[model samples]
Target: MNEKVVVIYSGGMDSFTVLNRALKDGKQVYALSFDYGQRHVKELACAAKVCEELNVPHKVVDISAINQLLAGSSLTDDIEIPEGHYEEESMKSTVVPNRNMILLSLAVGYAVSVEASQVYYGAHSGDHAIYPDCRPEFVLKMNDVCKIANYDAVEIFSPYLEVSKTAILTDGLAMGLDYSNTWTCYNGREHACGKCGACVERLEAFRDNNTTDPLTYE
Candidate 1:
């Protein structure tokens, strides 16, 4: 039997790229997205659409209560989503506390339940500065935890842990990924707010790659 892998998919550009990479690797892809009471449901919708288009099994776990319990981050709270480069200090307000950790923990359990050997996530170098959970160290430690916490060994496969966003975009383009179907705007408007940190970073990636972003911006 081919090794199966569970992808922590968010329907964002990075995670979408990771999903494609996993599919290209010939693994049975089970995508898991969380509806954690984030300010917008666009991402969830996009996730489903992407999965449907790719013919991949997808699950959206409802952990919206987590937002109420861990309120404060701009993503789950009423705070304004900051507009700046990802490296800006103000962008720290967007960090959902231990978000990747929580998501990966869930993914590990899902992987084990399905007897998958690997779990894939889209943590990249750009997120390491502000999001401690997205750093390589955290993923390595989490891999150890997964190995010990489960009867079967499940590896955390973060292919882009040290890769740049521009490089990721380049790979996605090579794979013919449709960027418009992926949602990255934190504001969750009908059109992307090009000023938000997520939007800025995505736009920068497209710019660096010398390609136009297919998504419309307000």
Candidate 2:
């Protein structure tokens, strides 16, 4: 039997690559997506669609009740989503409080229940500047906690932890992955607001890869 693993899929480009990578490694992937009252439901919708096409077991966990607790960030609150380069200081407003920790903790619990020994999330080098939870130090500490949190000792796997968005896109492209299924915009509007940090970074990644983004942007 293939090794069982849990993937924290957000329907974004990074997580999309992580999910497919896990499957390519011959793991039985159980994908978990959090509906934490983010600014938009577009990513969640994209996640569901991709999972369905891949025939992967996917679950969308609703943790929206804690939206108020995780407020202050533009992702879950009233703050304006910043427009600029991804690494700009202004993008800091997009950080949801303790988001990765909360999501990883819940993912660990799901891993325990499913007898999966590993959990993967798509926190890449691009997020290290603005999102503290996505930093290498945070992931290292989270891995330690994940190992001892339960009797099974699940391992936290972040394959793209030290890699850039371009590298991730390159990997996905090598695998013949269609990025159209992914969503990276922070806004819920009909089209992606290309000015937002997320959109800017995504476009940069595609540019770096010498390719075009499949999603339409405003």
At residue 190, what lDDT does model 1 achieve? 94
Task: Give the residue spans of candidate 2 off by over 4 A.
Answer: none
Query: What TM-score does candidate 2 reach?
Result: 0.98
lDDT of 1: 0.91
Over 1-218, each residue of candidate 1 has an lDDT whose tens digit, in order, gives 67799999998999999999999889999999999888767998999999999899999999888776786899888898888988899999999888888889999999999999999989999988888999999999999988889789999999999998889999999999889889999988899999988898999999999999999988
Colliding residue pairs in candidate 1:
none
How many angstroms is residue 117 displaced in model 1 relative to the true structure, after the best TM-score fit? 0.7
Candidate 2 per-residue lDDT over residues 36-150, each given as its tens digit: 9888778999999999999999999999999867668888887788889878888888888898899999999999999999999899999988899999999999999989988
TM-score of each: 0.98, 0.98
